[model samples]
Target chain A: SQTIHQWPATLVQPVGSPLSLECTVEGTSNPNLYWYRQAAGRGLQLLFYSVGIGQISSEVPQNLSASRPQDRQFILSSKKLLLSDSGFYLCASTGGHTEAFFGQGTRLTVV
Target chain B: GESVGLHLPTLSVQEGDNSIINCAYSNSASDYFIWYKQESGKGPQFIIDIRSNMDKRQGQRVTVLLNKTVKHLSLQIAATQPGDSAVYFCAADNQAGTALIFGKGTTLSVSS
Candidate 1:
């Protein structure tokens, strides 16, 4: 059983402001971590995924990036936010034996 | 999978009715599939999963059916309740099995 925790349930940032969202997992080791974004009425978009520490794969070219600093820690960061970056950001993890589990998500509103 | 620019499909049902949500995935090489339920302002919740080997898998009140032949997946919720009102979506592994690919969600609205 993997429990994912994401912080600051909601965020409102200026277009040029820097952004960082954190996701931490418990009860699993060497798990696959992921970052996804969903627009108000659209589907989930895969941002980045990491197989292990310091390994990240970007699905699409965007203003955001992801990193796995520790076995259970995954971070999504943006040097400068864009208005189009406003969406619901999600963190997910899948281990060798478990299905994908998602965190509560962070709603980002770029002003 | 590319994100749909359009809105998700909607399913409106009365309470106690059997609800079925449909999804069509791309990649035939995707051997694993999962279903998720998401409430407003919250993250997607794991509902059930079905592998390519088995065409069907059942949970407490939900069932996931896989059709690799046509590259389709479906979720069925028995006795749908108002609390079950949420966005239900499906995810599948890519050809490489490295990351999960998501499909546009279906908004399920159950009325009492």
Candidate 2:
């Protein structure tokens, strides 16, 4: 029974403000973590993924960055938020051979 | 460039009818495929998965079919209910087991 927890379920941040979204996994260790953004009616856009601590692979060049501070903790951050940065942020983890499990997701609105 | 795409952006089905959603991928190297369901304001939930070695896999009320030759995948929902109304996405694993490449998604609207 693995569970993923993501916080600030919803956030309204001003433009150019800093952003920090955290995701953590329980019941598993050394899992693969991923960060994705989904826009209205669009597909998920992979932002970052980490296979281990201190290792992050960014898929797109954008205003966001990711960090794996612990084996099961992943953080998505941004120094400044843009209007285009508003979307549903999802945190997912996989055991490498099974289906990935997703968190409740964070709905971020940059106004 | 490797990408996953859906054949349709939206679909409306009558309740109790069967629904079929289709997807296509560009990467033949992908060995795993998955289907996800996302309701409004919720994260995508895993529905079913199929490996490239198998052509089809079944879940409680859903079925996933993979056609490796054509690089296509499909999700079938039997006796669709209103609860089944959601955006469905198909994803493929890039073989490294590092990440999943997701498709644009198809919104299924089940009307009573």
Candidate 3:
């Protein structure tokens, strides 16, 4: 079975501070990874996706960026956080054919 | 631009009653669709999925109906329980299958 781990489960960051959220998948290789953000009472918005290491696609222009350092490791980062950057961030992976699996999301609050 | 949207933002049902949620998509090229359930403070969970080729699919207690002609989809939950209360979302895959575009969620509240 494959599992995705994301941390920290909850984060509180002051405005203009740097942000880093990590997601790692175990038991799968070369999986497609994605980052999505959900504002309160809103649907998820795809932020970024990666097909392979060092390959990332941005779905929307924003303050965040994503990186795939290894086959199973993906990171979401920001040089400076904005109040609008606060939301529940989710990490998901798919085998390219089946349904995607999601990790426990990270709740980020930028105050 | 193509997008997925739900017909309603909230739904209320009594226990043991059947629940139906509807969605619509604008992308004609979408070949795959999925339904997800998210409890409060938790990630969305895969509930069921249906391909564009099939009109309907069934899971343990849920059913997904796809109407490609109208570009519509629906999720049916039988014998609704309180545990079924959550926000449900519908998603469609692009022709390339590279990314899934999600619809605004419909919050379902099942009372016992």
lDDT of 3 by residue, B32-98 (tens): 8999999999999999999888999999999999999999999999999999999999999855788
Chain B TM-score for each model? 0.92, 0.97, 0.97
Q: Write the per-residue lDDT of candidate 1 for residues B1-112, one digit (tens) a residue.
A: 5321212489899999999898887788887888888899889988998888999999999999888898888888999999999998888887778887887889999988
- Worst 10-residue lDDT window for candidate 1 chain B reads B1-10
The C-alpha interface RMSD of every prediction is 1.4, 0.9, 0.8
Model 1 misses residue A69 by how many Å? 1.7
Off by over 4 Å in 2: none
**DockQ, per-model, please?**
0.71, 0.82, 0.79
Candidate 2 docking class: high
Report the C-alpha displacement of residue A25, candidate 2, in angstroms: 0.4
lDDT of 2 by residue, A1-111 (tens): 679999989999999999999999998999999999999889998889999999999888999999999999999999999999999999999987578899999999999
Please identify model 3 stretches exceeding 4 Å from their true place. none
Q: Provide the overall lDDT of each model, using Cα atoms, as 2-decimal numbers.
A: 0.88, 0.93, 0.94
Output the better candidate (1/2) by TM-score: 2
Give the TM-score of each candidate.
Answer: 0.95, 0.98, 0.98
